[model samples]
Target: MIRVLIVEDEPLIAEAHRTYVQRVTGFVPVGIAHSGRAAMRAVADAAAYGTPIDLVLMDLGLPDTSGLEVAAALTGVTPSPDVIAITSARDVAMVRTAVAHGVVLYLLKPFTFAAFRDKLDHYREFRASLPSNNDTTVSQHEIDRALSALRTTDLRASTPKGVAPQTLDEISRAVRAAPEGVTAADTATNVGVSRITAWRYLEKLAEDGLVTRRSDYGRAGRPKTRYLWKTKHAN
Candidate 1:
């Protein structure tokens, strides 16, 4: 399992991340740090336990110091956990720096669970293929496929070894097949991905003008937002 540390200050967002971690197959949240100082403590404890943290889902907007600064400090460790920026900020310069600091992924905020899970699953695949049998030299073809497939925006070739094409089909079918409209949470459950991944797709659909958002009402609790596929136009 990949041990993940979350360094987000917002309670709701942090809880959402924790929920996503629980839902994924091979991810475990080691701890949460609300501040950079607190983040150091959390990392120290996890490292002291010997497992350390395999990855960190960090928010760029931190209350204490810049998220990049925190990442810089963390990456200075002997064996740094791959940092995945999970923030709403889309500053290009900051992102460039993040890439330089060894961040494997950058996920924009307000994403669907499906998108988030897709990225994590790819990361898992990439890590799993690293010298599983170290006695022999790794083949170039194997290394190429591993790197190509791990990209969040890229799709793995059609095979049972990777995510099947039917998964995306199922998600589209689930939403288009809905009698009315599907909530982000429901779409994720139906697609077998996380809500964040599902939401990311929904956002893409929204941007493309394929799906229109309508506030779902008449339910007790938080009002559900439904993404209805546009019949007249494609998003």
Candidate 2:
């Protein structure tokens, strides 16, 4: 599981964020800290327990300390937690500093559930592409795919002409909602699109490492293509 530590001052908002993390596949909400000091302690405690946090959902404005300072402190720790700033901070200079400290994703406040899910899903793909155990030599394609998965947010940007983003998002949600996976035809039926159109979106997701594609040969003239949602810690 991708263990997450949510750092938000507001109790209601923090609870909502925790719930959101739980709803997503491959992610587990391990703890919530209401301030920067508590967040630091949580990270240390997790490390001491031998199950360090994978990500920190941090808020920029905290009563005690700035989130950026916490992020900078985390950078000095061994096996530091990856940060995704979930705040309303819109200052360009602060954003640049956050990037310098290795914040992987920046999510502005007042985002919808769909937007939040997209960021987490993207992170999952990027994490799955990396070597889980150790540092090792990797091919250029592997490196490129990993980086692209981390940076790419708009699926429409990479789709070939004629594929609509709205339809692609619908197809993605359908596949993700099915734990047992979905076939192209089934996705088409669910999303009210043609099988060919659904297949195109599925193929794109599979290529992007967001979903796993396999062949089902039982009771088939030609083997059927099956796609499943990639689960926790799958590499």
Candidate 3:
């Protein structure tokens, strides 16, 4: 689960945001902070307990310092979590300021679920593809592809890897054979390959809007990510 800290001053808005986060498949609403100062305390407490907050859903107009100021403060600390500014502030200057402070995505308020889900799915893909190597270097093509993936909002338009399209068919066959929802590990077993290879194919399906991923809750050491065929995509 992506542990999230929501910073919103209004009780109703905070609750609404919390509910939305809970409704998502992979997000977990760890706590709510009604003010910038309260946000700091909650994050500090979580960090002290070793359950580091993975992300912050910040609202710019906070009771304390501006949300940008709160983000700036938290980001200067060790192991800063990713910040995505979720606020009604739409002025270009404020958006620029949020981006200047390293906010990944600045979401304007009053969006429908479809628009919100699309942005979130892009973020999920981007996070999943983050570099694991110590070297910060990458090829131009890799950078271009990664950035393009983030800007893409249409699920019908996502491109899969350069591998043969037959891989998709093979995946469908393998998953269809199983009565239960399949994990990448399961696909890897069926295809005689490593789990990481399996994950790439499954993620491609997710990108193509053929599959939906959900956290496998209950009876597990770690939350295993599972993929279920979206009903509309099944043949």
TM-score winner:
2
RMSD of 1: 12.9
Ranking by TM-score: 2, 1, 3
Worst 10 residues of 2 by lDDT: 226-235
Better of 2 and 3 by lDDT: 2
Error of 1 at 72 (Å): 1.8
lDDT of 3 by residue, 1-235 (tens): 7898999999998898888887666788999999999998888888888887878989989987899988988876555677888888878898889988878777779865544555565566566555745367877866765565466334333444464445555675465446476899999888876898788888887866767788987685888888886533422
Each prediction's whole-model lDDT (CA) = 0.75, 0.86, 0.75
TM-score of model 1 (CA atoms): 0.63
Write out the backbone clash pairs for model 2: none
**Candidate closer to the true structure by TM-score (higher is better), 1 or 3:** 1
Once fitted onto the true fold, the runs of candidate 3 whose alpha carbons sit more than 4 angstroms away are 131-146, 152-235
RMSD of each: 12.9, 5.4, 12.1
Q: Which stretches of candidate 1 lie over 4 Å from their true place?
A: 132-143, 154-235
lDDT of 1 by residue, 191-217 (tens): 789998788766655665657889977
After superposition on all CA atoms, how large is the RMSD of candidate 3?
Answer: 12.1
